[model samples]
Target: MSASSIPGRLRRMNKTQKLSVAGISAVAAAALSLSLVPGNADAETEPQAISGAPVIFASAAGASQAKTIQSSVIEQHSTAEQLIKASDSAKAKAVSKEKAKKAKAKAHAKEKAKAKKAASKRGKQGASRSESRTPVFSNNLDGWIKESLSIMKAKGIPGTYDGLHRNIIRESSGNPKAINDWDVNAVNGVPSKGLLQIIKPTFDAYHVGGTPHDQYDPVANITASANYAADKYGSIDNVNSAY
Candidate 1:
């Protein structure tokens, strides 16, 4: 070989040896890192050399990248957790609001029911009072007799249907407009009129409260005459003949 070619060949041989050393050093570093891992103390770490090239160990860069990825993952997880918490809080608030709305509606329904019940009760009481105050009576002699009997009972005057009917038939034949124009009371300007045939002066003197003042009113005349009869003979039932 030439003297200059010998130096060039020696330089190439040194460069190849340096590359082989670098490849081996890289494989050793990879194995060391694997051994340093938490649960990989007994794990195998075999590195194959390809075409006698130096194995590049980018462990520091890979670790930096992994740390960045882990940070990003942690941040994503934290963000997800925060979103879940916010959603749960919103759901809870909605549930609470719905419950409050239902409670208010329930209370309103209860109050409405109570008011309806009270109104129904008041209506019933008012109907009962109306029934008591305004009784149904027929526009006839029997109805008048019964009505007078009712008034007599209220005024503490004693009489019966048979007694009042007999007296009314005897005196006026149940005629409310009957007038005793030829009687002593008629001559004295106070004629017996209406059913039970009571004179105006006598009717005025024995007029029961809550009855009409007119002697021609059948119920009023009957009530007043019965009052006089009750005062004289204890009850109209005791008088079978004219008073």
Candidate 2:
């Protein structure tokens, strides 16, 4: 073959190779473009890549949702913590109020106890003072008998001094201001007054010629009761029961 003919043949082969490469490149570019497009029926139907774009986007969206959830959870946790703190504060306040109430009640109870004790002491003192006011007779029986007999004779009562003394001793243990206040005869509402436990009605009936204060006088009370007994029982010797 000729040298010029051989060179021309080589050039034609090279051109053919270039055209095949260009066609192959164009086909690859078209396939890539189709894959990039959002809506292409053929591309949509094709099997996805190993590192899938849709899967990557879904993962990214999930991550974003997770972040949003985390933010909401943090906010909820904060609100719950605030609520817990408020509840604790309320509990503390309630406990404090209860403690204060208990303390006040205890104080009131203590005051009541103190008042009761003080009242009991005052009652004892009053009882002691009342007991001290009771009369005590002297040991000189004969002298007292003579004086009492003289008084009874002056009162115009038909009685010997010895009988009157015996009667007085039996009735009052020789105590002119003796009082017999028993549950049966002495009604709860009415008070027994002075010597002989003279009820108000009986004393009013018998009070002959004396002041209101004379009812408390030992001599006057004895004379009046003696006179009354003499009138009722005929004589002091005739009387059996003392009261």
Candidate 3:
């Protein structure tokens, strides 16, 4: 081959080599572009630790709100519990007060019944004592007069038994049933009757308490009449004018 031909062939070869190098460079550049674009897209689209700031702030805010709600709920529950406790305490006190009131009422009823029973027993005993003493003064006028004289002597009255007996015998004729029919001073239409011819007013004034009858109780009538005569006239002799 001539030198010129050799140079041309060499030039063609160099040209071909350069063209291949350029094509390879272009393909590598396109591959690198594709890879870099995908990486950048992934970095933008995928979740990143730094990009989650808003979500983290939102979560923290929600947690704080939840804590506030929880605290409020706890406070409300505690208040409700306190109210329940107070209600229970008040109910217990009311129950205790009612029980005490019932007990007091029961005790008062029992005491009242006891007092009534005691009063009834005392009344019965007094009646029995009066009944037992009735026979001693039942039917004897002279003995009743003597008892009157004894009682007067015990009371320190200045009178002899004989003088008192004589005055009563003259006034009543020794009859406990003696009555006065001719007296002009009859009161309330009831005639003066019984021992000592005592008028109704005088008999009422001299009647003894708890006697069976005002005039029929010989000892009581005689003793009361004697005491009245002594007090009003200073002695039985002073009433002899009326007798």
Best by lDDT: 1
Give all candidate RMSDs, comma-separated: 12.5, 18.8, 18.1
Worst 10 residues of 2 by lDDT: 48-57
Instruction: List lDDT for all candidates, in order.
Output: 0.87, 0.64, 0.68
Candidates' TM-scores?
0.55, 0.38, 0.42
Q: Candidate 3: which stretches are off by over 4 Å?
A: 1-57, 130-135, 138-144, 147-160, 164-243
Off by over 4 Å in 1: 1-80, 83-107, 110-138
Task: Give per-residue CA lDDT, model 2, range 1-243, as digits (tens).
Answer: 988797687567777576665666665676687677876655454543332122223478899999999999999999999999999999999999999999999999999999999999999999999899744444344444554445667666656665666666666665645555674446664444454455555556655454243555555555565567778886666765644
Clashing pairs counted in every model: 0, 0, 0
User: What does the lDDT read for residue 68 in candidate 3?
Assistant: 100
Clashing pairs in 2: none
Return the TM-score for candidate 1, rounded to 2 decimals.
Answer: 0.55
lDDT of 1 by residue, 46-113 (tens): 66545654445677889999999999999999999999999999999999999999999999999999
Judging by TM-score against the true structure, name the best candidate: 1
